[model samples]
Target chain A: MQQTRSIEMGTGLFVLLGMAALFFLTTQTTGSNSLSGSDTFEVTARFDNVGSLKNRAPVRMSGVTIGRVTSVRFDPDTLVAEVKLEIESQYDRIPEDSDAGILTSGLLGSQYIGLQAGGSDLSLQEGSEIEFTQSAIVIENLISKYLFKQDSGSDEK
Target chain B: MLRELYFSFVDFLRTFGALQLFFLRLLANSPAILVRRFGLVVQQVYNAGALSLVIIMICGFFVGGVLGLQGYANLAKFNAEDSVGTFAAFSLLKELGPVITALLFSGRAGTALASEIGLMKATEQLSAMEMMAVDPLRRILVPRFLGGVISMPLLTAIFSVIGLFGAHLVAVDLLGVDPGAFWQQMRSSLEIGDVWEGIIKSMVFGVVASLLAVWEGYNAIPTAEGVGRATTRTVVITAIAVLILDFMITAIAI
Candidate 1:
């Protein structure tokens, strides 16, 4: 009887420890910005090329994430990529004329949207589109352009 | 030679058939054990889970530390040392946590369960119960199997948590990476899907490891040598099964 009682106590503690670990993982580690949260507003931007920008990529202002790219889709009519962003409600003061640029982290890291706020009193609201946008810099394009410019310069010389 | 080969193939099929029948019997008997002999299951859980916690925690810490050291070295070449946290967290949560925990569990608890039941068979304790008309399958095997399945995912979860802590100790404390970026990048980049993949893998591994251990023991030849062989086979087969299953699950989940 005593042995069984101790076993029960040990089992209960082990189970509790496992539960606590799981709770920490779910609450602490992953992106908990559930889509169902009403504390965010969505906006759109268009780019000539999105490069490697993926859905859920961070939207940063001055290196601090304010939202995430919710979707990236091609617009056949515009011949561009339309990006949907969901910004936290707390960061609703972003100016209406801000610029959205797809930028990479470090030299070879994943790409995210970098937002440069404009000098305007009007704030961006739900469904508003940012007017000025920069597409991701394709490395191949840069290399080819550099080579072509050098060839032209050499020919002139 | 052909006759011998044919006999071996038939033996393999017979063993496979028996294993399938054994699993079905265990599943059939599980409900009764859950309701009536629940305390037995709890006792097995204590035996399998609490007893193995210390070793699992220690191994998790070391594996995480190694990952941090290696990740820092490789990422620093690219001037991306700051992303080591994200790297370590992904590897640990997605692959190492469930796979390594299952491997260790197979070695630790699987061997114990196999040998214990095999020795019982060797000593005729199982036969004694059979003579008394108590179904040993219901009275013995189902509780242990259930306990293992219940304990495995919990153990994997604890292992991952401790592992992340170990990585923090190395990456942030020793390596001088910014603490805020270390956690922030990991939080923002890690989706719920990666965590779910680990959970699902651990749950599946738990069932496979437990079932293999019990089946090996139950069918031992009721001798000392046979019991020893069963224990060895339990560890060997469980390790191979866990790796193959890990690859299959990762391919599907990814």
Candidate 2:
């Protein structure tokens, strides 16, 4: 009976330790490690297709995560995804002319916002709206459109 | 040909009826069975969770390392090697972690549950329990069922954490990914829903494994050789169930 009790205690302790490890690792993995000195700034980009662009999706420049998408919504009038991004203050010197494009990392991969900075003396301020954002190019849609275009051209011929 | 078809149909119906009867018995006495078989639950918890830790840790380490390596290789083709953590987290939490852990547990614990109970049946222990005015389902099956239900999720949690850490070590230490950047990518990519889906899958797997084990064990014929057959069937069925359930859960969660 004592042996059984000790084994039970050991199992309980092991499970508790495993739970603690899980919690600690989860916190460490998911905790934001961005530069603490930077103030938070918001930027908005509108796109036609947000293709797998999830909330809190990374906003990357040169393959480095600089911010995250705070929200993604549809503008019923424009039929576009209005994506709001929260960027760090230190990297806020993005030029007003900088273009944001929805880029696929690979074939059948996730979509992300890739920002290409333009050479401009003027910097974009907080709450600035990026006007020249390109939506994700859906591969299947592109293929269908190409095939349909060929069919139409043949009829015209 | 028609006669053979009729015979096959009859056999299938017979098997189905037997399975239905087993489930009926399980549902009828679930609560009472659970209460009476608490000790067995504790024993199973110890066996499945504690004794299995070493194998789980080893599997976790290899799984993490391989994920990191493969993720890095694929991302490297596009110079996106920095996104390894995001890949690792999404893969581990969304699919690999729960499925692999449950598969391992099913092979180890599920098979054991079937054989232990099957042997008991073969040895006339179940009949003895019945003769002594005890329900075999309550005395034996309940404890194993409860053990499985409790142990699986806990083991899955352990597997997920260990696998993530293993991936981290490979990505950061061996592959030379900046630890800070790796974690930042993970943070920005993963969501609460991903973790919740993994835990939910673990629980479902637990229930599926335990049910399959009990179903196989309780139906075993009273022969020493029948015990081994039940054990093998229990493992195969439980493993397949885990895989099929994983796909269903993934479709819903995604």
Candidate 3:
């Protein structure tokens, strides 16, 4: 009887632990910790290239995410990729003349737009375009450029 | 040839009727059994759940690690190694975790349920209960049935969590994927609906497998040879049923 009781208690504890673990997995893996609405203002930035920047990529300021890329498109007139960013409403202090650079976290990690605050008195508004933008750095392009330069120098030598 | 076809059809129908009769009786006895034999049911749960934990957790952790390692290798080819967590989570939560856990449960517990009950029948213990004016289905089958049915989903959920942790160890600690990126991508990619689907599938598999095990045991011939055959049949039939149900559930889910 005591053995049965102990096993019964163990079973209950086991189940509770399983439930807790499952809840942890569901929340952690799904990453939807936000309770507040996804309320944000949309803005645009143009770059010479987006370099495989997927839609729904993060927009960050000083490594903290402030927005997300809603869409990516090509403007034929400018011959550049235009990306629409949806910035959180709370981050309304970004200056109008601020720069948005397509940056990566670490080498080979996902590409994101890193925003730098500028010294302008005017802040960006909904649908505002940040003219100063940088494109994603393509490692293949850099590697090929270095290889070509090295070959040419060797031929001269 | 026509005679043989007719005989085979008859045999199939006979088996089907027997199965339906067993299921109906089990259902009829279920509510009464739960109320009257609550402690027995609890003891059955302890036997099944507590005993099964070690195997389930071990499988979850190793399977998760393998998934993480393999996912990293494939994602690394595209330099998208950070997405390993999302891949592992989807693979485990949506399909592998529940299905594998059910299969394992059938192999471990289903065989045991069959043999335990079958041996009792062979030894006339169940018949003796019938002589004493007790329904063996209420006395014996119900508690074990409830034990297996209840254990299934909890085991599957545990398997998934442990597997994810194992993947984390391999992906973040060993293969050098960014821990934040791995988790962030996984969280953003998954939703409540996916987890719910997994839970529902595992629960269904659990009930079906448990029923098959108990029914096979209850109907076994009163002999040692019959008991052995029922145990084997319990595992084989439960496994096939689980796979078929999984496919049907996936089709409807997607």
Candidate 4:
């Protein structure tokens, strides 16, 4: 009977501990991006090339994540990508004229949108598009361009 | 020869069809299975899950450490050593945790469950209980079945948790991989959907393993050799079932 009681107690601990581990993992992974309890507002940005920008990518302002990229769609007429961002309710003070730029974490890390605050008294409105946007800087393109320039210059010489 | 092959195929299908009905019967009678069974179920949980903790943890830790080491070696070649955490975590959470835990379970708990019930049948305990107006299916089988099924996912989760720590210990402490990058990449890459897939796989494997073990034991011939064969079949069949189920779930989920 004593052994059975202990076993039952151990099983309870096993379940509780598993729940704790799961809680820790989910919180750690989602961080502030959980979208639970926090209201979010949407804003769109247009870019020449969004390049590998995925849904749920973080949107940062001054190194702090204020939102996440919700969708990426190609604009057939403009020949650009329309990236929609969902900003947290707390970050409603972002200026109307601020620019959004796609940036890598390190040299080769995954891309995120970084918001550069502009000088304006009016705050950005939901559903309005941020006109000024910079696309992903493709390292391959830069490297190939440099190599092509080097080859042509040598040929001329 | 062709007629013999056709008969054998039909025999296999018949056995499979009966097993399917047995599984459905167990699941369909959930209400009767639940009443007065919680305590027994809990005891089964202790027997099956709590007892299995040590093996799961030890295996999880070593598997994690190996993943960390191998991932580091491979990622270092591309000057991308920081991504080791992401690699190890993803590997464990997505595949290793469920499949390996289920396989180990089929060996340890699966064999134990089969033998216990098979021996009971061999001794006419189930028949005696049936003669006493007690339903052995509800009283005996349900609790043990529930125990095995409930224990599996918890065991898998424990394996994953220990494995992550093992990976961290190897990648960050011993190998000198940047702790921030290791954790950061892991935090960023692992999503709810990926974890959900692992859990679902373990649950399905649990159902497959437990049901097969119980069914084999219940149907075993009433003799020492027959009980032994049933016990052996439990492990072998559970292992195959787990692997096949894992493949199906992965294909559908992916």
Candidate 5:
């Protein structure tokens, strides 16, 4: 009987420990953060190319992380990538005319959305779309354009 | 040779059929045992989970440290050492945590279960239970199986959390990686779906490992050599099954 009780106690502790670990992972480790909660407002931005910008990538204003990219989907009718940004409610004063650009970190780091606030009287509200956007810079396209420019220059010579 | 091959194929089919039948019986008996014999399951949980926690934690820490070290070295070449946390977390959560835990579980608890049940069979305890009409499958096997299933995801979760801590210790403290970048990248890159994938994989592995252990032991020839063979087979088969299932699940998930 004593053995069984001890076994039960040990098992209870073990189970609790496991639960605690899982809770930590869910809440702390994974970045299901302020953007995921109701304390954020969602806005959409359209890009000709989104490159490798994935969901949950940071949305930064002047290099300060203010939100997350909640979703990236193709708009077949508009023929562009529609990226959803979930901005924290505290940053509710972002101008409606801000420009959203897909920018890479360092030389070969992950891509993130950069918001350059524009001079506008209105603030970005829920469901408002950022009008001015710069698409992701594809390396291959730049290389091909450079090569094509060189080829045309030689042809002119 | 052809005749021998035919016989072996037939034997394989028979064993597979029996294993399937055993699994069915387990599922059938689970609910009743879970309700009435909950204490038995708890005892088994203690035996399988608590007893094994020390080794699991130690291995988790070392494995995480290795991942951090390796990740740092590789990412440093690209001047992206800060991404080591993301790399380690992804690897640990998606692949290593469940796979390593299951492999270790088979080595530890699976062998113990097989040998113990095989010894009981050898000692005629199972037969005595049958004589007393006490359904050994219900009272013995079901509890053990349930305990293993319940313990596996929990163990995997603990392993991953500890692994993250170990990685943090190595990357942030030992190395000069920016702590903010390390954690921020990991948090942003990982999603609930990735965590769910790990949980699902662990649970599947748990069912397979526990079922294999109990099944091997229950059907072992009631002899010393047979018991040893059953224990050995439990480890070997569980390891192979885990790898194959991991591949399939990963492919489907991705």
Candidate 6:
């Protein structure tokens, strides 16, 4: 009976340890955004095509993520996607003239908002709109345009 | 020439029909056999799960460490060392965690199962069971099959956890990565679907390994030499089956 109790205790410990380890792994693997202190600022970028731009995807500047896309909606009047971005407090000094482009990481990768810093001394405040935004350029559209241009050039020749 | 070709075609069909009949019988009796062999299944699960933990832990740790080191080195070349978490999670959850764990389990458990059952056959113990009105399939094979089915996903879950933690230790403790940043990258990178894929693949692998081992053992000829041959075949066949099934599952899932 003593031996059996010890074995039971050991089994219980093993299970508990395993569960703790599993929970740690799950939390570590899924919690990327560790923004602290609730000092978030919002900004908006309008684009013609978000193109696989998922909500909560990172907003990066110079390959360092400074924010995430909070929500994406279409302006019924303009037929443009109004992407609201949540910028962390530390990266609040983005200039008014900064350009936000919907860029792909690779050929078939997810879309992210890439901010190109402008040479403006006047920094944008919270709730300021980034007006100079470039929509996602589909590779297929670019290829077709290039082919058409080649045909037109051949006719000229 | 036409007569010879017709004979060969008939022979092929006859063999195919025999195989179909065997499979149908196996499938028909599987559930009933499994129900009757519940105790045996529990014992097999206890043996496989408890005995295999230490080796699985060691292998999981080393595999995770190597992945982290290699991933960190490659990403460092491009000044993107932060992406190591993503690489580690992707490799562990999608491919290495399930396949390596199953392969290890097959080596440990699969060989043991085949040899044990093969020995029973060689000693006329199976025939004695038949004389005693005991169904050997229910008494022996079903327990092992059910044990493997139950243990595999549990083992896989354990392996994935150990592997991730091992990578974290190597990256943050051994190497000079910030724990916060490493975890941040990992969290941002992995999806729930990635972990689900590993667990699902492991369950399938468990079923295949157990089935193959039981089949090989049951069909083994009654000789010491035959038991050795069956053991070898069980390991080889199960390993190959695991890889093939891994590919099929990945193709479907992805």
Where is model 6 more than 4 Å wrong at Cα? A1-28, A32-46, A51-157, B1-38
Q: Model 3, which residues run further than 4 Å from truth?
A: A36-157
Docking class of 6: acceptable
Worst 10 residues of 3 chain A by lDDT: A28-37
Q: In order, what DockQ does each candidate have?
A: 0.70, 0.29, 0.46, 0.52, 0.75, 0.25
Worst 10 residues of 3 chain B by lDDT: B41-50
Q: In model 2, which runs have C-alpha deviations exceeding 4 angstroms?
A: A21-28, A31-157, B2-6, B13-21, B24-28, B32-37
Better of 1 and 3 by lDDT: 1
Clashing pairs in 3: A29-B186, A29-B187, A30-B187, A31-B187
Compare candidates 1 and 5 on DockQ and give the better one: 5
Model 2 is docked with a DockQ of 0.29
| Best model number under DockQ | 5
lDDT scores for all predictions?
Answer: 0.91, 0.81, 0.87, 0.87, 0.93, 0.79
**Taking the tens digit of each residue's C-alpha lDDT, what string does model 4 give over A51-117?**
8889988999999888888899998988888889999888888899999999998877789999999
**Tens digits of per-residue lDDT for model 5 on B114-229?**
99999999999999999999999998999999989988989999999999989989989999899999998888778888888998999999999999999999988999999999
**How should the candidates be ordered by TM-score, best one leading?**
4, 5, 1, 3, 2, 6
Rank the candidate models, highest lDDT first.
5, 1, 3, 4, 2, 6
Order the candidates by DockQ, highest first.
5, 1, 4, 3, 2, 6
As for candidate 1, its interface RMSD to one decimal place is 1.0
In order, the B-chain TM-scores come to 0.96, 0.92, 0.96, 0.97, 0.99, 0.88
lDDT of 2 by residue, B1-254 (tens): 99999999999899878877776776677777567666666777787778777888799888988999998889889887888998988888768878888888878877887888888888888889999998787777877777787777778877778888888899889998888878877876666667778889988988888888888888777687788888888888878889999988889876
RMSD of each: 2.5, 7.1, 6.4, 2.2, 2.3, 7.9
Q: Report the C-alpha lDDT of model 3 over A1-157, residue by residue, as the tens digit.
A: 7887797798888779778877776666664335236778989999998987887777889888888888999999989898999888988889999999998867656688999999999998898999898878888999999999999999999
Tell me the lDDT of candidate 1.
0.91
**What interface RMSD do all candidates show, one decimal each?**
1.0, 2.8, 1.6, 2.1, 1.1, 3.2
